[model samples]
Target: MTILKNRLFWPAAILVALLIVNAFTSNQFVTVRDGHLFGSLIDILRGSAPLVLVALGMTLVIATGGIDLSVGSVMAISGAVACLLISDLGNQNSVGSVLLIIVIAIAVSLLAGLWNGALVALVGIQPIIATLILMVAGRGIAQLITDGQIINVQSGPYATIATGFFLALPVAFLIAVAAVVLITLLTRRTALGLLLESVGGSPTASRLAGIRSRRITTMVYVVSGGFAGLAGLIYSANIKSADSISAGNLIELDAILAVVIGGTALIGGRFSIAGTVLGAVLIQALGVTVVAVGVPPEATLLFKAVVVVALCLSQSAAFREKVFGRFTSTRTEAIA
Candidate 1:
């Protein structure tokens, strides 16, 4: 009962249900092919990797009582930077060139993160407005980098980032897992998590306690940008091209939804990386389920909206109490 009541329980249940549905709808949904995991289940994890990365970063930003609407734009810019550099290098296959391209892309993302942080932490601008500036401008910048054209690269190493297999599992999935583990260790094994919670819960109080709230806020945005950059790399790598306009189209919404469904309150405070991962997986699984069941493309978003609404309601304590108060009362009386 206690486990069932956990915030993550419902999302986990939904994921399981979706998996079952997919299994029945497609006989190959759970098969292994050529010593590699294949089918709808693997596809979900592979496809969800980028979103998972973005959600991980969003988790940190929301934990700091802030949001980064610019992540999608940042992702586009990251992809643009990498693809443009690779296209110009004339040695796309060279390991050195690939490494340099990646480094430059990450650097650009960090700078974008810094810019966002400065606006919010130093200029005292609202987070939404601050990030919005980049959200609108960053895509244009990516277009400028690509000269208003899609930048395509023919690098096997770069493509491997998304499509390659490692130990019979998708590399993208491994990257997401590694990111989650790194973030978990950084937050739980250190005092940073508590400090972030303090800042989110009460900025003034945290500052008075010498928590360096501004710095923490800035750091989180930077981290968010970095994650978005990595996600962008994965996105471009999967397609072998950088489409600035569509690289991360509306991914911010998906990331935000994942964070919220993972039990992280929008107003901030507590956060759960594990929950966020589960939420990302759940969203991807839902999409896979919809496709497997042959739901009309137009109704797909409607189904997602309904599920999101239900999940949000389930997370609402007041609503739950109102609906289940009688049952709770009866259970307590029986216990007495």
Candidate 2:
């Protein structure tokens, strides 16, 4: 009963059901080849890695009663910077140089994050409005970096960041997992999580309690940017090019959905890292399952939304009680 009551129960059940359906479509869906785990499941993990990073960051920002609409733009900017720099590298294959380029790209993303933080925390602007500015301008900035062209690069070391496997698993998946562990430790194993929840619950109350809410809020935005930057690199690496215009397009919406499905309320306060990870995977699984089942492209989103809505409804205790309470009452009346 306790396990059924858990918020993650429905989401997990839905994911398992999807996989079971996928297994019926093709035995290869869940099969491992030659002692190596290579299947649709693995592909979902690899493809969802970018969203996992973005959603993790989104979880942090939303936990502070804030939102980051600029993460998608940050992703674009980060990819543009990395690919533009990599394309100029004389060797284009030096592992060290690619690493440095990755660092610089992330640095730019940090600055973009700082910009959002400053606007929201320092200027007292609404989080949505503040981040929206960057959500619009950041794309232009990316375009400027790539001069409106898709910059392509050929770097074996860089390409491997997304495609390579370690221990028979994708490097991207491993990176996403590492990020989850790192953030879990950062927020849960320390006072930071409490502080963030406090601020999210009520900033004014947190201030009265002597917590530096502004600093915490600003810091989360910065972290969100950093994560988006990392995701950008992985995305560009997977494609071997940086598309300033199309990169990270509409990704912010997906990240927000992932966080919400993970049981993090949009109004803020309280978060679940593990749940977010599961939600990200579920989102990816839904996409793969829909395609595999041969759903029409035009109706794919509608079908997905219906499924997600059902899952969300399943998590609502009040809704369940309301719908089932009358039946139980009827039975009691008969007994009486």
Candidate 3:
């Protein structure tokens, strides 16, 4: 009963329910095609990779009571940089060149993140306004990098990042897993998690305790930007092209939603990487479920809203007490 009432339990149940629904809708929803994992389930994992990576970074930022609105723009910039370079290369298929280009793209995103952190931590600007400046300008910058045109590349190794299979799993999914593991170790294995929580709970209090809140806040934005850069790479590789206008459009919002749905409060404090991963997967699965169940294209957001509302209600302790507690009381009385 205790486990059932847990906040994460509901979302897990909902995810399983969605999976069951998918299984019923299609005979091969969970199949491994041609000895490789290429099913609807795998598709959800691949599709969720970008969102999961972004949400992981968002989780850290939210833990510090800050938001990075510029993540989408960072992603746009990263993808634009990578694809533009690949397009310019004489040997687009060279793995080494692609690797170097990936590093350069991510480096640019880190710089963008540093820019955001400096504004928020040093200039005392609000997180929203500080990131919003870049959010608005980032795409324009990406457009400039791409010369107002979409850049397509024919790099086989670059494409492998998104489409290749690794140990019977999508490489994109594996990348997201690697990110999740890195974050988990960084927070759980170190004192950084507590420091972040302390800062989020009260920046002034953390500063008084000599926590260096400013540096912490700035560091999170940098990490967020770097993760967004990775997401950008996966996204552009999935399509084998980069369009400045569409690369990471509104991804920040989705990442935020995933973080919240994963049980991280917007007001900051404690963070949950596992929850964020689950939330990202759930959201992506919802989209796949909609298509599997034949929901109309225009009604997609509506369906997602209904599901999100359920999750919100489930997360409310008071709501759970008022609703499920009564049932438990009734069952106990009947047994007595």
For model 1, residues 194-264, the per-residue Cα lDDT tens digits are: 99899999999999998899999999999999999999999999999999999999999999999988988
- Residue-wise C-alpha lDDT for candidate 3, range 1-336, written one tens digit per residue: 689766688889999999899888865776676768877888899999999989998999999999999989899999999999999999999989999999999999999999999999999999999999999999999999999998888899999999999888999999999999998998999999999999999999999999999999999999999999999999999899998899889989889988988889899998899999999999999999999999999999998899999888988899888898999999999999
lDDT, candidates in the order shown: 0.92, 0.93, 0.92
Model 2 whole-model lDDT (C-alpha atoms): 0.93
TM accuracy, model 2: 0.96
Per-residue error at 129 for model 1, in Å?
0.3
Q: Which 10-residue span in candidate 2 carries the lowest summed lDDT?
A: 26-35
User: Per-candidate TM vs. native?
Assistant: 0.95, 0.96, 0.96
Per-residue CA lDDT of candidate 2, range 36-150, in tens? 5778888899999999999999999999999999999999999999999999999999999999999999999999999999999999999999999999999999999999999
- The order by descending lDDT is 2, 1, 3
Candidate 1 residue 134 Cα shift, in angstroms, is 0.2
Query: On a 0 to 1 TM-score scale, where does candidate 1 land against the true structure?
Result: 0.95
